[model samples]
Target: MDTSTMIFIAVGLIAVIAGLYIYFYNKDKKTLPEAPAAPGSQELAHSKQLRLQAYERLVILAERIALPNLISRSNEPGLDKRSMQQLLTQTIRQEFDYNLSQQIYVSNEAWEAIRNLKEQNIHIINQIASILPEDISGVELNKKVIEFIMNQPQGSMHTMVQEALSYEARKLMA
Candidate 1:
């Protein structure tokens, strides 16, 4: 072939290659995935509602486990100190277990505070029970439990747990 014709053919091949490369590059850029959408307002509202309900339930649980309320609700005539202690402890455990699922909706700090309150209440009951004689009446045990609660620096665990729940609820509202 003539030199001019051969040079012309070479230039044509290079042009075609460049054209193909540009075409594929633009195609690939166009095909790139988009970023996901943010959560909708309905979903956000639902999550907030669930969290508020959890805080409310936790507040109620804390109140139910309070020493005075628990003693009044569970106290029975003719019961000994040991039986009364067991009853109170069992009631606290049951209340805690029922509300265990609420922890997922609440902040870690709030959940931890609730758990600590439960432990403190149980501790106070056991401590008072241990000091009293086996034959001590339920009425006497109830009185001692109230006296111990009265002496606590913060009044009671119930107040602390309730406050924590309230704080979290307020945060959600804000």
Candidate 2:
């Protein structure tokens, strides 16, 4: 098989592993028997709420960074393709940075998925921008990005990440 196909399979395997990790992590927690309310039960409840909120924010983050949503929200008429690429990448980085603390409340697998999605989007923007003529407008860059995503089978990795976040969050609720 081609290297790209191999790479795609590898990535798919990793995602499946992450999903199973979250599932078993939650399952182990769920199997624990409930005890009489202790003095620390309030603290545990508060901690779960914090984790839930972090997952909610991460889901929002995934939606915000998804290429189609980002392109529509960030469209500017007068800039060049390179500038657009910079803007897109910078916005993603900033969003990820702002939520860095949320990582502590989430599983390592979930955080890695979020980080991977951010990096992938940035890489896609840079790769597309690099191939276009230097004179193309930002609007054209945005169009090219949308077109590129539409053609790629794995372009909507953000959707997968969001679903994982939601599933984990629901597990926390349970």
Candidate 3:
């Protein structure tokens, strides 16, 4: 045989020997890890507990932030317009600031979205202030603010409230 044919035969022999070696090496290999249960069972349980806690937080948050309480308070008479606007804005800010730390527990997107909602509520209060006549009393301005809030995008007090609650949920889960 030519030198080239001999070289080819030697290369084929080496390739066959390597394949056989690997086949034998793996043939009797242990195929499983030592464990009493699936690898993620514990992890899943922990996650489930966290999710339940988050749900509880979400309920608490919704109850605390419900806008109806503000509306109910605004129904009273005899206050001045400027004072009423200030009161409304202050209330929104106070409630939001109260929960600001909760952002750490929620998802970033949810937290930011809620933060924006809080700001928007503040802005709406200011807008109501600007639109009120100088002689308008607190009761009247409060009326306008209520109307404006009701007239908001989709008349959705609940959307914003739910969004804020969702933010809290995300935080708790995290």
Give the candidate number with the greatest TM-score. Answer: 2
Collision pairs in model 2: none
Which digits, one per residue and each the tens of the lDDT, describe model 3 over residues 17-97? 344335434532634332355566988667656655644554454444444556575555777777777777777677777
Taking every candidate in turn, the Cα RMSD to the unseen true structure, in Å, is 29.1, 4.8, 25.8
What is the alpha-carbon lDDT for the whole of candidate 2? 0.80
Over the stretch 1-174, how does candidate 1's per-residue lDDT look in tens digits? Answer: 234643443454344334434543554365435335466777777888999999999999989988899999998988888888889999999999999999999877677767866876787677667767888898898998786556544345567557657865885786
Ranking by lDDT: 2, 1, 3
lDDT of each: 0.74, 0.80, 0.55
In candidate 1, where is summed lDDT lowest over 10 consecutive residues? 1-10
The pairs that clash in candidate 3 are 80-138, 81-138, 105-171, 106-170, 106-171
lDDT for model 1, please. 0.74
Query: Per-residue CA lDDT of candidate 2, range 1-174, in tens?
Result: 234743554465456546655665675576645445567688888988899999999999999999999999899889988888889999999989999999999988789889988877887787667777898999998997787667555447788788778877886787
Cα deviation at 68, candidate 2, in Å, is 0.7
C-alpha lDDT (0 to 100) for residue 151 of candidate 2 = 59
Of the candidates shown, which would achieve the greatest lDDT relative to the real structure?
Answer: 2
TM per candidate: 0.75, 0.79, 0.57
